[model samples]
Target: MAPTKKKAEKKGKIQEFCRKYLTVDFVKSLIFSPDKLSFLTYFILFAELALNILIVVKVKYTEIDWIAYMQECEGFLNGTLDYSQLKGDTGPLVYPSFFLYIYSLLYFVTSRGSNVKLAQYIFIAIYLLQLWLVLRLYSKTRKIPPYVIILSVFTSYRVHSIYSLRLFNDPVAILFFYIALNLFMDRKWTVGSIMFSLAVGIKMNILLFAPAILMLYITSLGYINTIIQLSICAAVQLIIGAPFLMTYPVEYIKGSFDLGRIFEHKWTVNYRFLDREMFENRMFHLGLLVLHIILIIIVAKPCYLFFKNYARLRTLQAQFEPQIAAENREIEDLVRKKMRKATKKADEEEITPEQKKFMDSFEKGMKNQFGDKQQMPQTKEEEDPQKIEIHFDQCVQLALLPIFLINFIGVVCSRSLHYQFYIWYFHSLPYLSWFTEYHTSFKILILFSIEFCWNQYPSTNFSSILLHACHLILLFGIIRKIYKEIGLARQVIKKEN
Candidate 1:
C-alpha cells in the first residue's frame, strides 16, 4: 500500500474526497505527485472531457462572443477596415492580427463567416497545442510521465476548458507564451524570442517576462548576444507588423500600453485591496507603486542569490570530485535500495511498474529528508567557484517573474477586476508548479478553498469585498514566496558555479 493509503481509507475514490473538508493538501499532493500519472487516465482525461462537454453544451450550444468577434472579423476580412480607423473609446486595439488571422481562416472555410462554435473549436486546437508543448517541457525538465501530464492538464481548474472556451486574448497569448518558454528552455533562442515577441504582439501583458528574460539573456550570452537575439526578434516582428506600423503605429502602442483608460467602472469581481475609486485619488496610485517596488526589489534579491548558487553548483559538478561525489552517489544509491525494499513490501499484492517507480522515488525522497547534510557539501571547496550566469534560457522561465510583478502592481493599482480576469490567476499556476519546492498540496488547498468561496457564495457586497481582500493577500503571499525561491535558487546556483 502507498503511504497515502491511510488518507484514502473509507473513501470510495479520490474525487469523492472533494466533499471531505476540501482536503486541499491531499488534492495538491495528487496533482503534483510522481505517481499521479501512473493511473492518470481514468481521472484527468475523463474529468476534463466531461467538464468540457458540459461547458460546451451550456455555453457553446448557444452563441457566445460570436457577435463581437464577427464584427471584429468582418471588419478585418473585407479589407474595408483600415484597423487605423477602428478605435474603441475605452482602449486601443491591442489584440494582434494573429487572432484575426485565425478568424479569417475559419470564415473562409464555411463562408458562414465567424461562428462562435467554430471559434471555440479553433481556440481548443490552440489549447491542445499548448498542452502538448507544456507537457513536453515538463517531461524534459522534470522527467514526469505522460499520464501525469494529463492529470496536470485537467486537474488545474484554473487552466482547463473554461479559459479556452472564452474568446479572450489570454488563451492565445498563453499558448504562444508557453511555446516560447519551451523553445527557450530547449535553447532555440531565435525561435523562442520570436515566439515571445509574437505573444507580446498578440497581448501586451505577456511583456511581464521582459526583465527576467533580459537578465537571462545578458547573463548567458553576454551583452552582445542578448542584443543579437533582440534584433532577430525585432526583425521577425517588423516583418509581420510593418504594414500595420506604417498605418497605425501610435494606435498600436497606445492600445498595447493604455489598459487603464478602458475601465470606467468602479469595481468588477476582483474588488479587494483597492478599487477604481482609490486610483482616482492619485495618492493611492503613489502608495501602491511604492509598495510594489519594494516587494519586487525584495523578491529580486533572493532570485539573484539563487542564480549564483545554481551556477556554483554546476561548476562544482563539472570538477568530478571523486571522493565527495562518489560518497554522495553511494548515499543516493543506498536510499534507492532501501526505497525499493520498502516498495516491494508495500506493493506485494499488486503494482504497476510506474507506480512502483513513483513509490520508490517517494520513499527515497522521504529518507533523504532525514539524511545527514554534512555528507553532501560541508566545505566551501566542495562548492563551485564560478559566478552563476543567468542566460536567456533561464530568462524564458524567469519571464514568469515579470508576470507576477506586473499583476501584483495591477492588483494594487487597478480599480477593479472581473471574474473573467481570474485567468490571470491561472498564469501563476505554471510558475508555482515549475519554480517552487514548497509543499504543493498545501498551496493547492489554500487557493482552491479561496476559489471555492469566490465561486460558490452568493454575492453580497460585504462578502465580495472581504473575499477580494483575502484573495489579494493570498496572491501577495504566493508572489512573495515565489520571488524568494527564485532568489534562493539564484544563490545556490551562484555558490555552485
Candidate 2:
C-alpha cells in the first residue's frame, strides 16, 4: 500500500510537469505565432522541395502544353514574328510576349524543349520559389492562422501536379504575381508594378488582381503617383510586347488578350454541369460578366467603408491606445530578428529564449483589424519609448486584403477553370476562409470540398455543383464580414454622436 501511494504521487508530479510544459496554449504558441511562422515556412518549403524532387524523379512527366509552347517559341526563334501565323499542336499562341520569351529560353535550356527531366527540375525550382514568395506574403501579414498553411500547401494534390507533374505556364506567371505581391508589401510600388505588368504579359488571368491593385495604387500613391504607376505598368507591357505589337498589332491584341475565346466544353472544370450549348452560349458568358460587375459594385461600398473605418481605427489607436504601440514593438522585434537571421551565419546566430509574453498577447494585436475595437483618445499623445514599426495589420490591409479579396471574387466568377488554374487562388483559400464568418470546421470543410472537387478529372456534375456551392458560401461569408464591419462602425459613430 505504501509503495502504490508513492508511485501514484510520482505520477501526479509527472502530470503536473506535463500540464505546465505541454499545455494547449504552448502548442498554439509554438505553431501560430508570427515569430514562429518563419520556422514553419522553412519546414514546409523543405518538405515540399523533397516531394517535388521525388515526384519529378518517380512520376512520369505528363506532356500537356509543353510541346505546343515549345513549337510556338521555335517559330519565334525562327524569326516568324507574326502572331497570326505562328501555330502549334494545340492551337495558335494565345499568351502574350513574356510567355514567348520564357518558353523560348526554356526551349534552349532544355535542349530545344526535348529534355523533359531538366525542364521538370527547372519548374520544380520555380514552384518552390513561388511557394516561398507566397509564404512571405502570408508571413508579412501573419493574418491567417499558421495551421491554415497546411490547407494551402499540403492538401492540394492538384497544386503539386500543376507545378511538378505537368509544367504549366500558369506557375511561371503566378510566380511573378507572388513576387510582385511581396514587393507591394515592401512598399516598392514602382518595381512591383513592373513585375505585375510582366506577370500580365505572361498570362491575362493575372488581371483578376488588377482592380484591387488599382484601388491600392490610387489610395496609397495619390493621383499623380497613381498615373505614373499605371504608366509604368503599361510601359512594361508595351516594351515586352513591342516585337509582336509593332508588326502585328491587331493579331497581338485579338489573340493574346482575347477575352471572348470559347474553351471546349470537355475541358471545363468549374462549369462541367453546363451542357456544351449552354457553356458556349454568348448570352451565358455575358450574364456571368454582368453578374461579376454587379458583385464587384456591391463589394465596392463595403471596401470603402472598411477603409474609412480603418482610417478612424488607426487614428484612435495611435492616439488613445498604448496597445498598438506595444504591438508595433512586438512586430518590430520579429522584423529585427528576421533581419539578423537573414544575415547571420549559423555560428554567429544567437539562441533566444521563448517569447511567451508576446505569445500571450497575440490575439490582442488584431484588435483594430476588425471594426469593434475603437476607443476615444484620452486627448494625450502616445509616448512611445521605441520607434513604432509599421503595423503588419496595416501592410496587410493596404496590399493583401483587398487585392486577395478581389482576385478571389474573380476566381469564383470565372467561367472556366482548368486544373492548372487551381494555383491562381490556392494560397488565398485560407485568407478567404479566415476573413469570412464561417466556423472553423466549416471553413476547413469548404476548403477541402473545393480541393476534392478540383481533384476530380473530367469534373463530374456533382463536383461542379459542390465547387460552385463552396464558392458561393465563401462569397457570402466575405460579404457578411464587410457588412458586419460597417455595422460595427455605425454603432460606434452613433455612440459618439
What TM-score against the true fold does each predicted structure earn? 0.63, 0.80
Residue 122 in model 2: shift from native, Å? Answer: 1.3
Model 2 ranges off by over 4 Å:
1-25, 32-35, 305-395
lDDT of 1 at 355: 80
Which ranges in model 1 have alpha carbons more than 4 Å from their true place?
Answer: 1-32, 35-50, 58-64, 80-84, 87-92, 109-114, 138-161, 272-276, 279-290, 307-415, 430-442, 453-497
Top candidate by lDDT: 2
- What does the lDDT read for residue 41 in candidate 2? 84
Q: Score each candidate by Cα lDDT.
A: 0.56, 0.82
What is the per-residue lDDT of model 1 for residues 1-497, given as tens digits with 9 covering 90 to 100? 65456566546566676765378865675556543433443454356555665666675343434455555666666663356554333322446666566555666764644456656656566666665565454433333434335534555554544454565667777788888877765657888899888877766666656655666566545689999999987786676666667777766455445644544344354443345566356565567567756755655655444444433444454464455556667767776777787668766766777987998897778668867442444555332233233322222334444444545454544444554455544544444433334465654554454455445323346645665555555556656666666667668989999
Residue pair clashes in candidate 2: none
Q: How many backbone clashes does candidate 2 have?
A: 0
Instruction: Give the per-residue Cα lDDT of candidate 1 at 140.
Output: 38
